[model samples]
Target: MPRTNLNDILIFMAVVDAGSFIAGGEALGLSRSAAGKAVIRLEDRLGARLLNRTTRTLSLTDEGRVFYDRGLQILASVDEAEASVAGQSGMPRGILRLTAPDAFGRLVILPLLEEYLRAWPDIQVEMSFTDRVADIVEEGFDLAIRIGATASDTRLVSRAIAAYRTRLCATPSYLAERGEPRDIADLAAHDCLIFASRTRRHGWRFRGKGSSWIKAQGRSRLRLDSGEAIRDAALAGLGIALLPDFLVADDLAAGRLRHVLPDLETDDAKIIMLYPDKHLLEPRIHRFVDLMVEALGRERPDARSSP
Candidate 1:
C-alpha cells in the first residue's frame, strides 16, 4: 500500500467540497491539473475510484462518497494537530466555531460576545444556534453548549459548565386565579407549560435545601421547544411554566412571575460543553472554554448583580 499523506486527503476534501478541480486548486493554491492529479493519486493509492468527473462538474462515486467522508475526518485531525502545537505560544487566534441552543445562545451567550471578542481580538468566532444536537466533529464545530444528558460518544469530550435548576412559575395574577399548588399532587389541577426539550416523561422536577427532588404530573396547556417562548407564556398568564432559573431571574425579582412549589424539590439539570477528543486541545478552544466558564460564573447568584 502506498503510504498516503495529509496533503492528498486535504486536496481530496477540498475538491469534494468545492465540486471541481479548478475551485479546489484555487482554494489550495495549486493549478487545476495539479488538483486533478492529486485526486487521481489518492484514488490510485486506495485502489478505488473516488470521483466521476466531466468537463462540466465532478460528482462522487459510491466509494468516493465514503472516502470523502473519511478524508474530511483525516484533514480535521491534521488541522487540530497543527493548531495544538501553535497554541503553545499562549495566544488563541483564528476561527473558532461553536453551536448551542437558540434561546440559550441569544439570551445567554450573545450578551457576552462583546466582552469576549474584545478580550481576545485575534480569535474570530462563528456561532450557530439550533435546538438539534449537532455533529460537532463531522460538521467542524470547535465546541457545543448542550443542556441535557450528554450522549456518550468516543469521538468527543464533555465537561459540565454549570448546574441549573428549574422553576415552576406563573404570573402573580395567574397564580392568584389558578391558586398555588401546595403539594406535588396538586399540580394535576393546574395548567403547565412544558419545555419540549428538557421536561421528563413523568412530569416536572423540583429541588429543595438538601437537593431533595419530587417529580409531579401536570396537564400541559402549551408545549414549546423554546425556553424564551415558555417564559413569555408564563409572563402572559398562559400557564404555569417549568423554566430554568437563569431564564427568569429578572421576572422573579420584578414580581412578574411567582414561584409555586418552593417546598417540593427536584433534580437540577446540567449545562455542559462538548468538543472533539481525537486531537490535542488548541489555544482557540482552550481560550473559548475559559471565556465561557468565566461568563457563566460571573452570572451566578452569588456574583454581584445590578443594583
Candidate 2:
C-alpha cells in the first residue's frame, strides 16, 4: 500500500458521512470536484472501489464499511489525545449538528441554543427540526433532542433532561357543539385529532377510576404528523387533541383551549437528549446538553391542568 495521506483519509470519511461529495467538500472547505478527486485517489491507493455511488445517493461498499470503522477508531483515539492536552482550555469551537422534534425545538430547544451560542462565542450550531427520527450515527448528528421517546440503540447514550405531562384539550366551541366526553368511552363520539405517523401508532393513556393506567384512543378522523398542526386543529374546533402541556399551556391558561379530562392523569412526557457514545465527550455537545438540562430541569407549575 502507498503511504496514506491523513487529509485524504479525512476527506474520504467526510464524503461517506455526509452521503454526498458536495456536502463533504463544503465541510472541509474544498470544492466538490476536489472532494471527488481526493476520494478517487484514496481508492486508487487502496486498490479497490470504496463507495457505491449513484447520481442520487452514495453508499459505502463492504471494504469501505470496514475502513470507515477503522477510521472512527483512529478518530476517537485522536480526540482522546487532544482532550487530554487541552483539558484546561477545552472550549467548544465547532459546528454542532443537532436534531430535535419541531414544535419542541422551536418552543424550547431554540431558546437554550440561543443562550449557548451567546455564551460560547466560537461555537456555531446547525439545527434540524422535524418529527422524523434521525439516526445519530448514520446521519452524523452531534446530538438529538426527543420528546416522550424511548431508544434501544446501544451505541448511543440517552439522558432525561426534563419531564412534562400530556393534556387532552379542545376549544370551547368544539366542546359546546359535541358536548364534553364524560368518560373514556364517550371519547368515541368526539373527533380526536391524533398525532401519529404512517408507520407508528399512537394511543392516549390515562389513569382511570382505580388509579390504574388504561390505554384508550378516541375516534380519530384527522391525523397529522406535526404536533403544532394537531394543536391548531384543536384550536380551530376541529377535534380534541392529546398533546404535551408545553404546547398547550399558553392556550389552556388564556382560556382558548380547555383541558378535557384534567382529573384523569396522563402519561409523563419525557424530554430526552441523545448522543453518540464516546470515551471523552466533545466540548460542544457537552456544553449544549448541559445548558438544556439547566434550563429545563425544573417543575413547570403553569403547565399543571385544572379540572
Candidate 3:
C-alpha cells in the first residue's frame, strides 16, 4: 500500500489542537480550504469520519479520537527525536492549553502563569476558566487545574498541587438578622447559598462529634455555579455560604463576612492538576507543571488569611 502522506496527519493534528480549520491552517502556513481539504483527504484515506464540524464548533468522532491519540503519540515521538539533539531539550516552546476552575484560575493560576510565561519566553498559553468540569482529552486541553476534584479517567494523570481550607460564612447583617447557627442542625433554619451545576453539586461537610463528618442541612434557596458568585451572595446578605478560604479570606478579615461554626472543621479543598497520560510530555507542559508544583505544592497560610 502507498504510504499515507505525513503532512496530512500533521494538518489533522493542528486542526484538532487549534479547534478550527482556519487557525490550524494558519499554524501550518496553509489556507482554511487547504487545511479542510487535508483533513478530508486524511479521513478518506482512513475510510472514517474524524471530525464533526458545524458552523461554530468542531468535535471529534470516536474514530477521530483514536486517530487523534495516535497523532499525539507520533508528535511526541518527533519531539523526543528533536530533543535528543543538543540545545533542543532545554528550551520549552509551544502553546500550552489549560483549563481551570474560574475563581481559582483568576486568583491562583493566573499568578503562576505570569511566572511561567516570564521564565519561558518561547511558550504561549491559552486558558479556559470555568467551574464546569472539562473533559481534558476530548476537549484538547494539555492540562487542567481542578479544586476538590480528581481524575477518574484512565487516559488522564492526576496530581495533587495544593489544599485550601474552607469555611461557612455569612455577612454580619445576615447572621444578625437570621441568627447564627448554634450547631449543624441549626443550619436548616438559615438560607444557604449552594454551588451547583448540571454536572455536580457541592455539599458542605463539617466535623461531627467524635471524628465523624456530618453534612450541613442548610436550606438552599440560592444555588450558584461559580465560587465568586457564592461569595458575592454571602456578601450581599442573600445567604450563608461555604467557600474556600482563598476566596473569602479578605471578606472575613475585613469584617465584611463572619465565619459561622469557626471551631468546626471542614474538609480541605484539594487542588489537583490533570493531564493526558503520556510517556513523554512536551517540554512546555513539563515546565509548567513543574512550576505549579513548586509554587503550590504546600499549603499556604496567606491563602487562608487576608494578606
**Which candidate has the top score in lDDT?**
3
lDDT score at residue 11, model 2, on the 0-100 scale: 99
Top-down TM-score ranking: 3, 2, 1
lDDT of 3 at 283: 80
Candidate 1, residues 1-307, lDDT tens digits: the string is: 5479768877988888788899988999999999989988888888899989787989999999998767655644555677767764456655678898888888888877767788778666789988766788788898888776665677777777687776778898997898888877888998888767553322576654476665667888788777787889889999888777889878998999998877555555567788877445777777777778876753232111110
Clashing pairs in 2: none
31-118 per-residue lDDT for model 2 (tens digits)? 9999999999999989889999898999999999999878876775665466667763477766688998899999988888888999
Candidate 3, backbone clash total: 0
Once superposed on the true structure, which residue ranges of model 3 sit more than 4 Å away at CA? 1-89, 299-307
User: Considering TM-score, which of the candidate structures 1 and 2 is the better prediction for this target?
Assistant: 2
- Candidate 3 C-alpha lDDT tens digits along 73-105: 676556555555533356786568899889999
Candidate of highest TM-score: 3
Q: Which residue runs does candidate 2 get wrong by more than 4 Å?
A: 1-81, 84-89, 298-307
Instruction: For each candidate in the order shown, give its overall lDDT on alpha carbons.
Output: 0.76, 0.83, 0.85
Per-model TM values vs. the true structure: 0.66, 0.71, 0.72
